[model samples]
Target: MNLSDRQSKLLFGGLVVGLTAVGVYLTVAAPDDEPERSKPRSVVTTGPTAPVAPPPGIATPVSPDSFDVYRLLPFSQQEFATAADLAQRFTAAYGTFRFDEEPRAYADRLAGMVTEQLGGELQRSAAAPGLQEERRAQQIVATGTATLDRVRDIENNSIIFLVTGKQQVTKAGKRSDDSKQYAVTVARDGGSLKVYAFEPADAGQEGDTG
Candidate 1:
């Protein structure tokens, strides 16, 4: 409709105020966007989600087996085996003797396996005139065999074995077996194993020939 400028301006201003009131009322009355429907509330999980039932009559292991006590010892497995072998050989050498072998050679075979002090004793015992003469007259030829009975004791760097030394003697075409038990000590000697000391099982006094 044709109207004056002042009337038109008044009408435009009233329209603007009415629209602003309506916008504010609509904004306050409208609810939120339904909180996005909570997205069905999915959760992620991993690894052994449930307690697994073991098989019937099977026991659950308390824990994995640990290391052996022997592994904690100071010596290596090879060293221990070497020491044991040395002990057995030493006992065998102690009783084995050839009829034609010299006293020095016989003693040397055993002396080399023993400590210096023990070796000296063995050398003296082997070189005895009377013992050598008797052996020669009897024509004795002995072959020795050894077996370990038990471990008598253990030290930091040594082990004592209860050994039975068996000797098969042939004299004048007659054969006989002789067995004796001794406590044999094997110890470390300058990066090698040697017979430290040995005695009869009863620890009795030994003759000069021991």
Candidate 2:
């Protein structure tokens, strides 16, 4: 069920309704939830040069071999920092789910980072009793490590992060772990970059530990 990059893009038009959890132990995820969104933070880079957004009508170039969309294109430093910061915040918020916390509370925490469609998905899947029951019975807890694997511009105002991370699931006294890669898509909403889709790279594929 691994979705190719083309298929992933199709989801932008509301083509997909549910997404697999990838390596996450919780499979029940996808419900509608909304929380107040915070304003996007301003980007400040080193040096006295003030960064400004690119003007309209200019096409941002793409790199076929790398994720550095701004590498050859003329882009302000602020854009780089903004994309990086957004990716960091989304990863932090996404990887912090706890079994002991209430699902609604968790959804609230992520409301600002995700789009409404994604929020609903999160609430539904997180609130599932089956997932809760399994976690409770196994004393399972999960943690994730997100790394910026690559970055590329999607549309003029959006960026996609090729993120690599490790998900560690501890059940009872034993732990099982796997490393996974995901493409987290973000688009500019007002002044903030909001996540619209969270899809794993090579979806439906599993990693092997050596």
Candidate 3:
């Protein structure tokens, strides 16, 4: 059937509170005295967001070709590679959004990479009428970076990761940035890693885009 039908099968609301909490971390800065004026774009699409060059010294997956090969030895080579890949994609999907477009379209673009439940939640959140108005009024668009900080637990069925990233907000043309760290958990679903839950990373607490 249709995508919405598929997602309806997975409907649940237990994580709404937690997800809203995560969204709260996306703080908006006070508008600058001379807010940079940005030309309004006519459309928005789901194509890959402009690539964000990872900052220096950020944690990343140990490359198979690098000297740090031993760092990835604890997990099976295949699982480590898959988890790393998922972490990156999840970051890209979750971190990128365009305020000029319809929210459902944005959520639709992210659907394939996430679980049905999450996809539905995203769609509902995006479809909220006030969301678009708020973005338009604020004249802001945000792009985020997701970096894999550490793999805390790996099991046959799931993986836990600590992720950190920068959320860059461009408002009325001027840009401001903030850093967020999260504990993420993902499970293997049909050979792909899909995020199950996420929370702010505390000084000690630990845990992807899809």
Show how many residue pairs clash in every candidate, following the order shown.
0, 9, 5
- The best candidate in terms of TM-score: 1
Q: Write the per-residue lDDT of candidate 1 for residues 57-143, one digit (tens) a residue.
A: 867723348645567776677877787788889999999997778988987888778998888888888888898888888898999
In model 1, which range of ten residues has the least summed lDDT? 61-70
Which lDDT tens digits does candidate 2 get at residues 94-176?
76666687889988988988888899999888889998888778877777677887774556767788877677878887988
Measured against the true structure, the TM-scores of the candidates, in listed sequence, are 0.63, 0.57, 0.56
Relative to the true structure, how large is the alpha-carbon lDDT of every model?
A: 0.84, 0.72, 0.72
Across 112-206, the per-residue lDDT of candidate 3 in tens digits comes to 76778877987888778887787898887888888888987776677778888678998778899878877677777785677765567674434
| Whole-structure CA lDDT of model 3 | 0.72
Error (Å) of candidate 2 at residue 20 is: 99
Candidate 3 is scored at a TM of 0.56
Q: Is candidate 1 or candidate 3 better by lDDT?
A: 1
The CA lDDT at 122 in model 3 is 75
In angstroms, give how far residue 9 of model 3 lies from its true place. 99
Ranking by TM-score: 1, 2, 3
Model 1 lDDT at residue 189: 88
